[model samples]
Target: MDPVPLLQALIRCPSVTPADAGALSVLEAALQPLGFACTRLRFGPEGEEVENLFARRGTGSPHLCFAGHTDVVPPGDLASWTADPFAAEIRDGLVMGRGATDMKGGIAAWIAAIASLPRDLPGSLSLLITGDEEGPSVDGTVKVLSWMAENGQIPDVCVVGEPTSRAVLGDTIKIGRRGSLNAAITLHGVQGHAAYPQRADNPVHRLVRVLHRLTAQPLDSGSEWFEPSTLQVTSVDVGNPATNVIPGTARAKLNIRFNDLHSSTSLIALLRAALDAEEARYELDTVCSGESFLTSPGPFVDALVAATRAEAGVTPKLDTGGGTSDARFITRYCPVAELGAVGATMHKADESTPVEELRALARLYAGVIRRLTAG
Candidate 1:
């Protein structure tokens, strides 16, 4: 039940993006022997099936669920990697793979830690693993949680094993994440020769003005467990190569990382108000990736901090500064927090985690279980 080998095995799977590639089966093989009942649930649009796993042991209240995913994003520009992205090579003291540090390692660590615990231990244990985390997420945790609710299996408190640690292992645990929204704007204007300054309505100028208004003001100073919300313009392009002609249309893309100060609906209204103030002809589309959520530093958070201090010997900081994750949907069902290993190499070339750190993370998960299930 050593986590290093388990982590290496998970990294070896080419379960890139939406593909399962036997990663789910590999986890099932390990969990079955641990005396846990495992169930596979697939949800999505008719033809596209997203893989999900929900396994539980014992029928007890205060059920503690460990939620995570087995999927890894595609490895871009493979030549940049010292080892094959799916090869799971071990060098120096780490294993290099796409999901090595981002996730799969953390999932393996928890399973190994659970394997060390007695099967007849107090309370209940369950795992909710999804393979659609790196994709559109339409058929992943959201659907699985709904299914669990219908079947009467929602746990009291859940721990998401996303790569939440920073700087040092167990140095921080995430209690929330800033909400994310993507917006695309298209401004319309009359096209004319560059020399005819008054003949053409400069849409670029209007677009610039609106952008200035949006960025001119601060979203917020930040929240207690979260950072100040900020909006960033990701792209602006007219795709015009001509230097003498005025482009008829201007387009720009922006992203917002917001705190509890606002919701997606309210922010969209804010954007529209800014554009309307300029009275410009424009079309805007907004997509909400996630909404902000916080569990606060109450009993649940206090227990986690206490466990970290006792086990890791350092007072773990509670943070809510990261981008969105599956935890957004989980918040609707029950209280949830994210705790895992150091994330120094997540989603990067030659991504990896130390072998010793992997085992230590397992021990940490064990401690969390002990504290949460103590009743």
Candidate 2:
């Protein structure tokens, strides 16, 4: 049940994003021998299939669910890596690979912790794992949770094993996360020769004005447990190749990380109003990844803090800073928090984590389970 070997086995799978690549099967083999009943859930349309797993050891109240993903982002430019991205190479006291820290390693640590616990000691213990966290996310935890709700398998509390720690293991516990909204705007206009300035309605000018309105002011000062909201214009393109012709359309894309003060609906309305004031014909598309959520400090959070102090000797910060995570989806069902290894190298080329740190994280998770389930 040692996490190192398990993590090595998992890292060997090239399970990037939506591909399973036998990652879940590896986990299943590890869990079945430990008395857990495992269920494989395949969801989404035929073309974009997502594999998920739900496993449980007991059937009673006070169920503590550990949620995570087995998927990793694509290893960009493999030639840039020091070793094979899927080799799970161990050197310099670290395990290097695509998911060493961003998540697969965290999952391995938690499973190892679970293995150390008494099989009959808990009211309930379950794992909700998905392979779509790094993909479009249409067919991952969100679908599995719906299935769990239908089957009456909701847990009392949940812990998401995302890489939330910034500097040291257990130094941070993300009590919540800001919501994410992505918007694409396309402004329509007439195309004309440069000589006919009066005939061509310049859509670029109108688009620039719209972007100015969106970024001119702060979304909010700051929330009680959240940071100030932010909006960034990621791309602006006219796609005009000729110097003599004014483009017919201009498009710009924006991403907003918002706090509790605003919801996606509210922000969309604000954007629409801005476009209306510009008096330009335009098409806008907005996708809300998740809504802002917070699990206020209480018994569950206190237990996590206590466990971290005992196991890692650091007073963990109750933070709401970070990009959106699956915890955003889990918030609708139960109180959830995020705690895991330092994420300094998560999605980078040589993604890695020290073997000692991985062992420490396993111990920390064990302590968390012990504290929460103790009678």
Candidate 3:
């Protein structure tokens, strides 16, 4: 039940996205002894399959599920680390590894917490672990949830073990996340000499006008439990090298991290309206990573808050900020919240978490399990 060794074992696997590297096997071995019925789910296309697991230990009400990803982002610039990125070394009380905080540590902590509990809890306890969260995400939790729904395995409430805490462990529990949208706009125009008086139209000028219109106004002042929407122009491209010639086409890319006050659909309409106002020939393409969702305060969320306060001795703020996680997919089924160790080191070189913090997270999760199922 010591999360340190479990975390070290996981960090040793090099289970980067789309590759299990026996990490799931290690987890299965641990869960099987706990009487968990583990199912290995392989999804996605051939040759690029994703590994997922859904393990449950009972069939009763108030089914509580823990969701997390075993995958870790690739270690960049390994020379910067004091040790091997996959070493999972416990140096000076820190579990140093690529995913020590980004997640594998959270997964280890949850499994350890479950081990510390009784063999016969009142309600079902389950885990939805996916390996595609760091990759394309086309074959991860979203697919697993679909299978769970078809098989009648969806949990009543779910806790995502993402590193949501900021300054200290359990200080922040993510109640929701803002939606993300990426748009690529291409404006076409007739090419001609820059010296020409009125021979050609300038697409760059038109694109700038469109962009100004989009960025001129704030999406909203900020909604309850969320922040104001933001639109940022990420890239503007005009490949013309000659200053003497006007470009034939201009391209710009923008990203919006919007709150619950707007959705991808509404924002896209707003963009199109601005483009249409220019009366120019253009093409717009967009991809929405996730729509904003909030798990309103209720019994399930209140239980998480109380457990965090009791176990970590910190009153966690119910936040709806930050980028998206797989919790976005789980929100469709049941109320979901995120809590784990402080994320100060996640996705950074020499990522790590204090060993004690990892253990404390286990205790916090244990408290969450108890409070959630106590009813």
Candidate 4:
């Protein structure tokens, strides 16, 4: 029931992105003995299969599902670390690895908490874990939720263990998150010599004009429980070999993190109108990761706030400021919130969390499970 060793075992798997690397097997091995019925789910195209796990301890209402992902972003440079990223070494009272904080630790903590509790104490307890969270996410939580719906495994309320704390563990909880939309714009034109000013149609200039139009005004002011929407231009490429010749094609990519004041559809229309105003032939492709959503103050949220205060000795703030997560997908099925450890080192070179903090987080999660399932 000690979360540290289980977390150490999980970090040793090297389960980067879509690769299993024995991560779920480690989890299954731990859960099966604790009376959890584990179901392994493989979803997506033939070659890009994603591994997911749905483990439930009971079948009843008020199902308290703990959602998280074992897949982690790659450790960029091994030389930058004091120890191997996959070694799961404990250095100076810290667990060091790729997902030590952003969330293999969280998963291990929750499982340890569950193990400490009586098996017959709650209505139901479940876990919806996915392996595609750090990747494109085409075959992860979204598909798993759909299958859960068909198979009657939807929980009453869900909590995502997404490393939401800012300065201290359990100091902050994400009640919602901003929506994400990625756009790619490609403009085509005639390629010709620079000296032939009359023959060459410059696409770069047109693309710049379009970008200017998109960035000229603010999307909106800050919304209630959310920050102002933002549009950032990430890249612009021409791929022209020579300076004298005008490139035949120009492409630009941008991302929008929007609040609840707007949806992806409305924003896409706004983008299309801007392109139409330029009267240029271009292709606009957009991918909507998720729509902004908020879980209002209620019994479920109240239970989470109360649990954090009782267990972590802090009145957690209900925040809605972060990038997208699988929580966005869960919001469609039920009210969901996020909580976990301090994330100062997540995705960094020497990612880690304090050993004491990890143990305390397990206790805090135990409190949350008790309060949520006490009905």
- Across residues 275-347, which tens digit of lDDT does each residue of candidate 4 receive? 8887778999999999999999899999999999999999999999978899999999999999999999999
TM agreement with the true structure for every prediction: 0.96, 0.96, 0.99, 0.96
Best of the two (3, 4) by TM-score:
3
lDDT of 1 by residue, 1-375 (tens): 898888878888888878888888889899999888999999977777888999998789779999999998888999999999888888998888989987999999999989878777788989999998888998999999999999989998899998888888889999998899999999888888899969998888888999999999898898777789999999999888999888899999999999999999999999998889878789999999899999877878887888778877778888898778899999999999999989988989999999988988898888888888776
* Full-model lDDT, candidate 4: 0.94
lDDT of each residue in 290-335, candidate 2, tens digit only = 9999999999999999999999999999999978899998999999
* Range of the 10 consecutive residues with the lowest summed lDDT in candidate 2: 115-124
- Reference-based TM-score, model 4: 0.96
Clashing pairs in 1: none
List per-candidate RMSD values in Å. Answer: 1.4, 1.4, 0.8, 1.5
Which residue pairs clash within candidate 3? none
Candidate 2 clash pair list: none
